[model samples]
Target: MFQQFSLTHVQFMLTGLGWTIGLAMIALIGGSIAGSAIALMRVSVNPVISRLAQFYIFVVQGTPLLVTLFIAYFGATYLGISVQPIVAIAVAFSFYAAAFLGDIWRGAIQSVPKGQREGAHALGLGRADTLIHIIVPQAVRIAIPPTVGFFVQLIKNTSLASVVGIVELTRTAQIVSNATFKPLEVYMTAAAFYFLVCFPLTLVSRGLEKRLKS
Candidate 1:
């Protein structure tokens, strides 16, 4: 039975792994942009803008990803919209990623000392100028560690995309286990693959955190 683990299965799973990585990259990049916007919005002095951003973060963070997936896929159909699973999963994960990242970045931005902002003001730097040249750069240094850590979570969350039939790594593992009748071996392999993708990131994030602290 062990000998029956064919190269074709390996090939298929490898392809699925690629898709998983691709989707994760998409989510990370798109989420980073959207999340930055939301983060800035959250910190804006405009009460309406801040509240809207807060509400968006609340709704996305409050709901489970599975429900988000269902809504992106099936709910859209109910609303007379056609959606592909990959597209639906990407959209859902992007929004989910944005919410968490927004919060993370907001914290980082806020962590800038009040005195620093006051100093910037004294230097004749207006709010926008201060944020761009002073606050954001410092915040970025503080943000790097957690941002990398969040990437690991983002990669893992891509597994949930499988429920929408996106044929990513988790879905491939399911297919392989169904075929090989070796849940243990297949899942173990999948776990190793996930670890391979994430462990280095974890180390890098930790290292950055330590260096920043120093």
Candidate 2:
């Protein structure tokens, strides 16, 4: 028997929406921490450290995120290690996000004018001091636009968590659609939820870009 899409179904999806937001937050925080290390390593004076960071980025970027998620979730069982779904999703998304964030940050750091570094050197500031005080402040301005853009993308990508049994928004929509036999109504609601989350971030990104430019 087909049931009508009702308020109860919307409430169920709201629960999923919360999980989606939670997952994206986990990915963002984890990714930012790891990505900071990777960015610093990429800019290291040591050739080996820089090359290693480059290699890590290369490998992660080359692999599809779905594959990475599968490896983090399902592959653990094959190796006799138990992994929770949320834990696996966090780890996979973090690792995937780190590669791209690292590169974005690296470009931002490098985009700092050469003359600024020279000026810092003239003032006898060491590399570390110059980076912390002079370079990083400027780099942050450059990084913000892209970083927020990626975060919006990350929020949408959390839908993929459904593959690993995550009851995030998309998964909830699936369940509701199955129960109600109203795929169109269920999925459209899910899309609206996504847009509501993402559109504000898009506006903020644009606002930041304009502010930085001014």
Candidate 3:
């Protein structure tokens, strides 16, 4: 039995889209902070600190985002700890984003010309000032395209948060589909919304890349 899709259904889906954006923002902010630390630590003079950051990146990047969310949401039962599903989803996605962002940025930072770094030190700037003043500004431009790309990925991955009961876009579509028995229409509509959100970012990423090239 199928019911016709209505304007209300469209509005319902729109609300879900809001949640998707919110989740993506959470992932972006949390991931950036953690990623910055990891990237800096990876370049540390101390071998031990560098190795530990490397290990963190390896394990995180190696694991699937869904599995990480599962552990964050469900693994807590093993220790009798309980957390809200949204909290778990946010934490998982953030850490997942962090690993990839860290790698992206580490490459960007290392890509800065060696002479530039030496020049900073030669001017009597300490390592920290050299990096903050000279290194990161250059690295950030290199980082933008990839960072935007990862944010797009993060937006799509928020669908997984629905599995943990976070009522985001995909979850909303599932509900709408069930109510109207029009899974195809509802899902296609959901896909359209996703494209709507992501296509602009893709264009922006391209524009930024071109700008950087010039």
Q: Model 3, range 125-206, lDDT digits (tens) per residue? A: 9999999999999999999998998899999989999888899999999989999998988999999999999999999988
lDDT of 2: 0.95
lDDT by residue for model 2 over 14-109, one digit each (tens)? 999999999999998999999999999999999999999999999999998888998899887899988787998899999999999999999999
RMSD, one per candidate, in order? 1.6, 0.9, 1.2
Which one wins on TM-score? 2
By TM-score: ranked, best first: 2, 3, 1
lDDT leader: 2
Error of 2 at 47 (Å): 1.4
Global lDDT of each model?
Answer: 0.90, 0.95, 0.92
By summed lDDT, the worst window of 10 consecutive residues in model 3 runs over: 75-84
Candidate 2 scores a C-alpha RMSD against the true structure in Å of 0.9
- Candidate number with the higher lDDT (2 or 3): 2
Better of 1 and 3 by lDDT: 3
Report clash pairs, candidate 2: none
The alpha-carbon lDDT assigned to residue 197 of candidate 2 equals 94
